[model samples]
Target: MSLRRWGAVLAGAALVAGAAVTPALAADPVAPKVTVAPATGLDPAGTKIVVKGTGFDPAANDGKGFGLRVGPAKADVRDRAGKDFQVSRLIKKGAVGSQIPLDDNGNWEYSVTVKAEYVASGTTYSAKKQPFSVFVFGWDTPVLTWDSTTPLKFTEAGDAATGLAWGLRHSWRNYVTRGGGTVTPSNGATLDTAAPNVEPYPYKWKYESSGEGTVSYTGQVTYTFEAHTIWDFTIADPRITFGGDGAGTLTAKVGYAFYGTKTAPEKVRTPSDVVLADLKLKAPAQAGDNVAVDIESAKLTAAGAAAFADFYKPGEALDTGRLVFPGKSGPAPTSSTVPTSSAPPTTTTSSSAPCVLTPDSVKQGNLLWGFKQSFRRYVGIGSGTSITASDGVEITDIDKIDGTGPPSGAYLWGFDSVQYKSATEFTTQFRGKVTFAYPAHSFELSIGRPKVVVAQGKGKLFADVELKTTSGAPSPPISQPGVELASLDLAAAKTTEGAGALSVAGIKVTLGNAEAFAKFYKVGEVLDEATVSLGASCAHLPGPGASGPGAGPGVSDDLVPDVKYRPDSALASTGADSGMWLLWGLVLVGAGLALVLVVRRRPAPGQRP
Candidate 1:
């Protein structure tokens, strides 16, 4: 009977057999089902609008959720706009809002976006008119009317109002929207899309007058603009290669001019005359060729204005005709040539002349005759050497004597002293007399005479001597004063040795002073067992007793009278050297006895002999 209460319960139950009590079954809400994703668009401000709500009511509203309202379309009624177009709060499914802005007024239609509601416990579920669209944030200007039964026509009556303001400023700067600014157009209307890759004439917005107003043509009055896809149209400065049949055509006539109010009949613009009618361009067959285009541009036609007057006659004249297009002339650029080869006719042989050492053939009076020398100075081993001027040395006063240009030959002589005859080494054999003072000892000698540069050529006689002294006396542990000497190819004579004699085993001495002594010589030192010779002599001695030819009072009648060793009948017909033609006939008889002793001792040019 622990079920004591159970006993009572049974009694009560029996008594209440008439129990009709059964009430607790609620699950009937779910009225959500909302949706919005894009659906249409243009610029609903920030526009994100998601809203999705499927059978909502997860524990009804007590859970505090569901209720996304995105304005307008009667706010999706649920107790007459509860929470008035709420903006977002739906949670049993979805609700993304982006703040639901909306206001661009340039109205291109379609508006309403997601006005969902969900409520729950108290019951309410809505979502109607979720369309979309905002548009109008920039260029959309469209009012352009003019098309009265093909009325506007002006062949050229002074260019009918400048071709109706140049076809309405190039059709509103090429179909409007230059948002980044700049669009100028006037009588001469230009704006061919500023060139570069061109392409911009496909416009729209139709309806011309009959349905009453709206025009932006490129579709009629002869429209035609196929600039061959204009690849950066440059005309000159060397860039003239345009062919693929470049084209053009833009005629215009359009009519109607009323201006609002004739019971609403607006349609304006009736002026006319916009041509560019027949421009052709396809000319490059040579001036840099590259063709292609059998025909297109709707099969072209207008070959009018004499085809643009020979289309710029061979093209090249664009100081601003601003694109007239019509080129076609071709052929006239042929110049290639580059073959060259002709150089095999030289020859050149003539040799001879040149063994000349002249100063009037080695002068005489005061003696000059240089070449004919012999040297040997070393003072040892063979008993202090000996062999000074083995028959050479005579130069006493020969002044400027120069020569060159005789089949590779040169000689320059200037002297003032040379008596020579030294020998000391403690009197190895005793000898005295010695002058040698050229320019007081800074001597110089250069000779290279030996001609016949070709025909059996074999000539070479060289020498370059130098000697300096600050006060003479050198030959001991020599010290700096100078002493160069060379003899390179010294002797090879025989261009038929006319002037003959010269053989010291074909000379080749070389020993240009290496710092003068340097402890007894070492720089290119080559004595080669000493023994040298060079010839050619002359002597008359007796001339410095001055009396005329300005030999006195600071003399210098420009010191004339050398006549550069005269005698050159073309250098004596190329074989020269008959002793230089007997010293050129004794230097023309000593220049005719010194011009007859200066004209019997000048007393002319204002006297004074």
Candidate 2:
């Protein structure tokens, strides 16, 4: 019944030495003094409860410090009323002196006796006992944080927010490496499971004393693990590839949150709650691999808060969750549905017309071709001159086609050469006419290189004006010369044959007259160098940079639509094809079986059965 009696039996059985050495049956010495201190007094869950005692002999030499024998080291406060608490593990023992602390936990009063044997004049005497009462408070509230530098707190409820209240102990899962420990604080206060209405943690504070009887709660408490903004914002899925000289890296911020604790306290006091900012991701090349990041909790400054918002949504701060860093080419949800004004217009009409269909000639002077100079080359003049009765002499239906038109050196319809000579032939001066004459009206149009209109002479005769290329190049050639009435009536030019609608080439006129001075106009078009301007904040960050021939490495083939053939496979093909093939196979087998049956059933004329 007594621990000293139990210790003597244990020592005798545990040690090979006989009863003469066993420290039992000796007279009781002095009662050992015991003192206990809870590891975390505020919220003791896995917190230590150290029991310090003295009067045990330092050396009758067994073990120095002692472990918990009958009581539980961990308290379970899941059921506070019934007080269902159990001890979890024994603390490691160290050398014990006059004051040795035994680490254990429980609110109940228990006794721990340290034993030591002393031989006095060939006789042995038993040491004294050390007893203590453990008063563990506030072990019901669980702290579900991982190894982080800052403490994870809850969002404090204010006058506008709902007041804090305890609920039924909910079953919650904490993610950690198996055998990685977690501390539960509820059970430490009281293991009274039957008393469901009882407060898990005694509301010893004066603030909650008024609403004592009204608190009705039940159910298992669940706590989900989430990462913080610090770890979440850390870049992942970094992609690097060669540009001209250095490699470009593309990455986007990513994260997740679990719905357990809807709100938590903030360790750092700030003007606003920690939130995530929408991220401006930049990279030179396509990132093939996913970036791994760990988000930790931290306080944000004014600038940091703005930056965080760019990466995360409002109220959804980065919590403890594994995120696959978004790649440059990954599909992401549209952040905002409202389109921006600066957003490129899907269908744009330019103020100044692109290469126009005309019957008149371009007479811009001294054009330069393929020069390493300006951004755009000179396209031909708007020659598709329609003289409306209301808008006489005014070229009708000619306006700028913004963000669209013939790709470099392409004519008005993106087909046929705009240049009179080959791309390699370079000339300095030339006169070409893009003349479109109606039965009653005539328009003379001229275009010079880079993009210059030397003259657009139009009366009942010609559009007499000067034209110049955007780069002030020598005159480009005049193309597509024919009577407007005759060319518009051609059936071959207005036919739509295949999958897509009729293309620009479907409508065409004769490139009748094209003349360029061999020396003045340069041949062999050069890809112009484009200068892109970016905004201040987004300047250093990767803006819409030019990509090489293909998307960067690790580019998935699935994204690029297979335009080669069988494009209507989703609609054209179906289960019917497979079913038809199966039906044919089944019919063939049936025919073969029928033949076999016929052969077996055939009668023999010469022989009797």
Candidate 3:
């Protein structure tokens, strides 16, 4: 073979190898496979990020490596938009992107700061923005993330660093400033109510203090809004502090209903002094111990006063008048005296003073009394005529009478308006006109005589008497056939002043037409007898040098009566009735003896003796 032929063959073989190698080299340099450590991060500022790449021309441009851009877009490097989007740096196989200094408000789509670029053979070659893990700087700490694409979730501490980069790009605009406090992002606090019926999303940020100090703090955060009409509701108090920690929680609470498009009011006015939340800070206490301020007891303006007034009427005073607090334990003082029944009179009566029972110095009032009677009468008129009567006597007013003046025999008059039932009228013959005149310890009850003819009929009747007090045991029935009237003698126990008990004793019923009545009531009939207790007292009345009636010494105008009724041994044995029963027994015995004698005289042991 010729030398030229060998060389041509070798050159042909070399051309084939070179052709295959050229296609491999010309094909798009496999975009530098890049990965970013810590794919996502908290916004505003976070930990450092590392970029790693493979299959990149390490010797491109004399070992200058790939040119990396850590920004929003590749065009951002060309047009020098602010430093945030125009970050450019040189990266090697495992180089780190420059510390991207972001503003307090972080960026969302800041591409993985590793773009491969090389200048080869007088031609510049650059790879498009490579698909690398994202490093998102967000405004929140990523504790909870909610957006249209990402389901709301609370990130656990262990998984917070993993693929947490999602729809965190949109700007959370500020809605309102309230509570006279400062929020992070400098007024960037907003309420997102875009989702229908969903709670407004809150932006998490640090709250700082303002001009308002802690003392007059009303840590109430309320949101005033209107869906159809203006309404106000509470959210949370950001000013809550615990153990003097400034890094306290800002709890978000749902307030009023959402504003619908059609239901929204024409003009939704923003409240001037509306507080969205309270800003709390830890402070030292006077006792050298840390204590959180009580939010409930703190004086705070009602955030939604107008809204509250719609439900509850305003300006009405609450009734707290009858409330009483128990007194603390303590010993009774020597000067404090206890009331006793045997206590001596505080006033002494002079010897020269008359022993008369002055009406002015006695307690008196309307009293009611009652007694029962049974007798017979013939009706003079077909039906009895009813009449009312009053004791023809009058006494000075108890308040005007003076104890030192002349004793007034004026009776405390009692009047009865008698209503005659048909049965009662026929039986008593309309003789029920009763009246009472009461002096200190005694009383006179008078029943006017009936204007009817007597007859041998029998019936029961009640004589309605007006007694001083009704506080006593009731009397038993007075059922003597001949008895026409009954009497009760009242005696009051002695007391220096004030009301006391009165004893009703010495009960006696007078018999009318005893001789004719004895035919039916055999000299003795079982008469119902009873003892009644009267709640009466000798109360001192208004007089010269005397405190008002019923008032103890050093007391005045205490005219309340303390009448007490107690019954004992209700009725005395009916002595006259017992004697009547004994006489009947003798008569019955005599008759029985006469019957036995007649039987004995007739026969004895079947033989005539």
Order of quality (lDDT):
3, 1, 2
| lDDT tens per residue, model 2, 417-455 | 222121111111222222222111122233221221111
What TM-score does structure 3 among the candidates reach?
0.16
- Please tell me which model should have the higher lDDT, number 1 or number 3: 3
lDDT of 1: 0.22
Query: For residues 426-482, what per-residue lDDT tens digits would candidate 1 score against the true structure?
Result: 000111112222221122222221111111222121232233333222322232211
Model 1 clash pairs are 209-212, 209-213, 371-534, 371-535, 372-534, 372-535, 373-534
Q: Which candidate is the best by lDDT?
A: 3
lDDT of 1 at 447: 24
Q: Score candidate 2 by lDDT.
A: 0.21
Off by over 4 Å in 1: 1-392, 396-487, 491-609
> Could you give candidate 3's per-residue lDDT for residues 299-320 as a string of tens digits?
1123432323332233321110
Cα lDDT, all candidates: 0.22, 0.21, 0.24
